[model samples]
Target: MEVAIDNSEFSYLPAQAEALGVPLPPVERLTLPLADGRTLSALRFGSEAPRVTLLHGAGLNAHTWDTTALALQQPLLAIDLAGHGDSSWRDDVDYTPRTLARDVAAAVEAWTTQPQLMVGQSLGGLTGAALAASRPDLVSEVIVIDITPGIDVTAGPAALREFYAGPTDFASRDELVDKAISLGFGGTRPETERGVFLNTRMRADGRVEWKHHFAHLAAQALAAHDPGSATAPSVLHETGWDDLAAVTAPITLVRAARGFVSEADAADFQRRVPTARLVVLDATHNVQETAPVALAGLIESATPARRI
Candidate 1:
C-alpha cells in the first residue's frame, strides 16, 4: 500500500510545460509566516516581482495552475490557500472566502512589489473578490473563473460532492486516482494519476491522503446537511455580492460553459457589478486544466499595461 515515489511537488512541471510548448521558468516554493503562527505557501514562477497572483479552489493547491502558468510565461505567484496544499491548516477550520482573503492579502503584499492582476477559480474566486474589496491596493484587477456569488451550493456537480464526501485516505495513490475517476472527476487516467501524485502524500502509516483540509470540511458539511446552516463555510452558500460591489479594482468574470456558473448566475453578476466584464468559455469547472491556453490569453488581456 505504501507508494515509494519522489516527493518533489515540482517534478511534473517539465512535462506540463512541454505539453504547452513553453520553456520552463525558474520556479521556487515560498513560505511566508502568518501572524497566527501558521504559514502560507506559494509557487513563484519567475525571477522578477510577480505581475500576477493566482489562487486555486478548495481541495486544490497551487499546482492546479501549472498548465496555466506555463502558458502565461509571465512572472506570477500561485498561492496555496490556508488549509490547502502546503499551507498550514487552521484550528477553527474556517475556510470561508472572507477569512481566506485575509491570508491571501498577506501573501500578495509580501510577494508583489505593487498591484497585480489577481486570478482565482471556484472558492478562490470568491476569496479574490473579498481581497479586492478589502485590500484594493494589492489587486489592480481581478479575474474570477467559473464562479458567481449566486451559485447554489447544493446544486454543484453531484460527482464532485460525492468525491469530496467520500473517504479522504486510500491505501495507494492509484487507489485514490481510481476513486476520483470512478466518481467522474480528475479527467483521464494519466492526468488523474499526475494530479494524484501532486495532491496527495504518503503518510508514515503507509496510506495516501489528500493534502487539503477542505476535504474533511466538505465531508462534514455533507454529513450534516442541516437546512440553512449558518455555521457552514461561506463557500457553500454565502452570496459574495457585497464584496464584489465594494471592489474598486476592475473585475472580469469568466464563465465556463460546462461549469458551475450558469447564464442566470452570470447575468446576476453583471447586474450586481455593472462595471465588470463577462467572458464565456467552452470548458468545465476546472477551466485552467481543460482550457489553460485560452485562460492564459484572458489573463493577459485583462492585465493592465500599468499597475496602480
Candidate 2:
C-alpha cells in the first residue's frame, strides 16, 4: 500500500518534506552476511555519501530512520540490524550491543569505502560508540541519539520485556498494527503516524512481531544495564568522563529533549567528547517523528558537508 502522510495525524510527510532534501533511491534489497553467519537486510537511500550510515535502535529496524535519512541530504544507508527486521538471529548466542556493534561495523565496511558518519539510536548508539573506538578510521563522525553511557539502561530491558514477554499472534496485518501502536508509540497515535508504524513486518503465521529478536535482545539489554557490569556508562558529571575519548572524528549527540536521555547527561556527553556538538529536539524518544522539522534543521546545520 502507498503510505500517506496526512494532517489527521503525523503531518510531517513529504507534503512538508523539504523541497531540497537528499534524493531517495529506487526499490532495492540486500541480504548481507555478518561475522556470526547471520544475514542482515539493509536499504540504501543514495550511494553518494560513501561515509554516511544511520543505525536504528533495539526493537526498531532501519525504517525508523527513513525520514531523518532523507532530511540529512547525503547518501544514506540503513540496516534492519541482525535479528531485527528481516535479519536472522541466533537464539543460543548472547546478543550484546558490542556484538551488534560488530554487526554494524561489518555492514559499514561492506557498503562503504571511505570513512562513515554513524548515526545510531539507543542500542545502536552504544554499538556505534564501540565501533568508533574499535575502527576509528571507518567512522567519520558519530551521532548517538537519545542514549548515553550514563542513561538508565534498565529502561530498555523493561520495555523489551513488555514488548516480547510472549508471542503476539495476529490473524492479519491490521491486528498486528494495533498491538504495535500500543507497545511502541504509547497508543492513541493519529492515523497519519500509523502509516509509518504499519511499515513493520507481519509474518505469514498469525503473529505480529517487531523487526528484532526480542527474546535474546531482552536478555542482552538487561545485562548492559546491570549496575554491577564493569562497562556501565558514567554520568555526565562524574569524574574522568570520557565515553568516546578514543574516537578521533567529531561526535554529535542528538537527543529527544523529552526522551530517555537526561538533559544534564546530554550536556555532559557533549563536554566529554573532544570534538562534538549537542543538538536536542522538543520531542519524545522518537525525535525523527515528533520533531522532524526541528531535527532536520539541526542536521542541515550541524552535519558536516558530505562528499559525492
Question: In terms of lDDT, which candidate is strongest?
Answer: 1
| Per-residue lDDT of candidate 1, residues 168-229 (tens digit) | 77888988787788887766798889888888888889777878876666666766773233
After superposition, candidate 2 runs with Cα above 4 Å error: 1-24, 154-163, 180-208, 215-243, 302-308
Clashes of each: 0, 5
Candidate with top TM-score is 1
* Candidate 1 Cα errors over 4 Å, as ranges: 1-7, 220-239, 304-308
Q: Candidate 1: lDDT of 241?
A: 88
Query: lDDT score of model 1?
Result: 0.83
**Poorest 10 consecutive residues of model 1 by lDDT?**
226-235
- List RMSD in Å for every model shown: 3.6, 6.8
Question: What digit string (tens of lDDT, one per residue) describes model 2 on residues 40-66?
Answer: 777676655446676776566766665
**How do the predictions measure up, each by TM-score?**
0.90, 0.74
